[model samples]
Target: MFTRIASALLVAGLLATTAPAAHAQTTAAKKAAAAKKATAAKKAAAARTAATKAAAAKAVAARAVTPKAPVAAPAPLTEAQASAGVKEALNKGIIKAVQFASEPDGFNLNDDIHIPTPPDLEIVKSTVGRLPGMGLVFTQLETQLNRAAEAAAPKAKDIFLNALANISITDALTLVTSGSTDAATQFLRRSTQSQLISAFHPDIEAAIDQVGAGRAYATVTDKYNKIPLMTPVNLSLADYTTQKAVDGLFILLANEEAKIRKNPAARTSDILKTVFGR
Candidate 1:
C-alpha cells in the first residue's frame, strides 16, 4: 500500500511538470506570430511611403521640365514718328539760333547783316529814305516793317516747331538716311510753307502800307518791269515776305547746328545726345 501511494505522487508530479512546459511552448508560438504580423505591417507601410515619395518626386521633376511661354519684345516707333523727332530737334536748333541772333539792336542796327532788312525792298528803302519829302516816310516805313518783321519772326518758330513735333519718326529716319544735305530744310519748307505764308501775309501787307514806301515800291517795281521784257512782274508781297522769313530762319538754324557740332553743352537733352552722338 505505501509503494502504491509513492508511485501515484510521482505520476502527479510528472504530469504537473509536463503541463507547464506545454503552456510555455504555446505562449512562445503566439508571441512569434504577433511579432511577424507587426513586422509585415511595418514593412508594407514603409513600402507605401517610399512609393508615395517617389510619385511626388516624379511630379516635381515633371513640373521642372515644363517650358514657359516666351515674352514678347516691345514694338518699335514708326517712321513718321521718328521723322517728327528729327524735326523737333531741328526746330529746337532754329529756336536757339533765333534767340541768339536777336540782340539788343537786333536786325535794324545790323545793316552789314541783311537779315534784318524788310522783304524785297532793301534798295528802295535806302534809296527812297535819301529822297526829298519821302525820306522821313520811307525811314518810318523801314522802321515799321523791321519792327513788324521782328514781331512776326518769332511766330514762325512756333509754327515750325509744331510741324516738327508732328513729323513722324519714319520721316526723320528716311530724311537722315537719305543723305541729303538740305533734307531737313526741304522737309520743313514742304510741311510748313502754306502755314508760314498765311501767317506772314497780313503783317507784310500792313508793313508795306505803313512805310508810305508803297509808292516808292511801285515806282521801283514798274521801272524794273519796264526795263526790257521782264514779263508783267505781278509779284506778291506774300512770296517775298515768306522767303525772307525762311531765309532768316535757316541762317539761324545753321548757326545752332554749328553749336551742336562744336560745343558738348549745346547738346542739352538726352535726345540730342543720342541723335548727335558723342
Candidate 2:
C-alpha cells in the first residue's frame, strides 16, 4: 500500500512539472507566430510604399517629357492694307524707273539694257566699221538709238499708272504678298510691256528720226551694200530699240522692287512700312 502511495505521488509531481513546461512552450510558440506575422506585415507595407514612390516618380518623369503649347501668331493683314501696300510698292518702283530712264545715260551707259546694233545689221556694221572714218559709226548708232528710247521712258509713267489703276483687288494682293522679289516688276511687266510697246513705238520712231540714228543706220547699210558680195539687211530699228528700252526700265524697276522685298530701309512709304515690316 505504501509503494502504491509513493508511485501515485511521484506520478502527480511529474504531471505538474510537465504541465508548466508545456504551457511555457505553447506561449513561446504563440509569441514567435505573432512576431513573424508582424515582420511580414511590415515588409508588405515597405514594398507597397516603394511601389507607390516608383509610380509617383514615373508620373513626374512623364510630366517632364511633355511639350508645352506654342505661342499664338499675330493677326492677318486686312484687304485694304494689302491693296494699299501693293500699289504703294509698285508706284514707288515705277517712279524710280521712270526717273532713272529719263536721265541722259539711262539706256546708253547701262550696258545691261543698252540696245545693240540691230542684229540684222551685223554684216553691215562689221563691213562699215572696217572703213577708216566709219569705225565708230555703228557704236554711235547704238548710242543714238538708246538716247531715243531714253526720251521715250517718261511716257511709260502715265501708261503704267493707267494700267495700275485697272488692276483688281485680287491682283493687288497677289503682288503684295507674293514673296517674290520681282513681284512689283513682274506685275508691271505683265500689265504694261505690250501696251508700252505700242505707245513707245511711234515715239521711238520719231525720236530716232529726230536724233539722226535712222540716217546713221542708212549710212552704214548703204556703205556695206556698196561693198561687193555682202548681203543687204533691213530690220525694224524702232521695234528693237523700243523693246530694249522697255526691258531696261523694267530691269531697274525690278531692282527697286527687290529693295522693297529685302531692305527695311527701302520701305519708305507708310503703307509699305506697315505691310512689309510685319
lDDT for each candidate structure:
0.63, 0.86
After superposing candidate 1, which stretches have Cα over 4 Å from the reference? Answer: 1-88, 97-105, 109-144, 177-182, 210-239, 261-263
Candidate achieving the largest lDDT: 2
lDDT of 2 at 138: 80
RMSD of 1: 18.4
- What is candidate 2's CA lDDT for residue 226? 83
TM-score (all chains, Cα) for each model: 0.50, 0.72
Candidate 2 has a TM-score of 0.72
User: By summed lDDT, which 10 consecutive residues of candidate 2 come out lowest?
Assistant: 119-128
Could you give candidate 1's per-residue lDDT for residues 43-73 as a string of tens digits?
Answer: 9999999999999999999999999788785
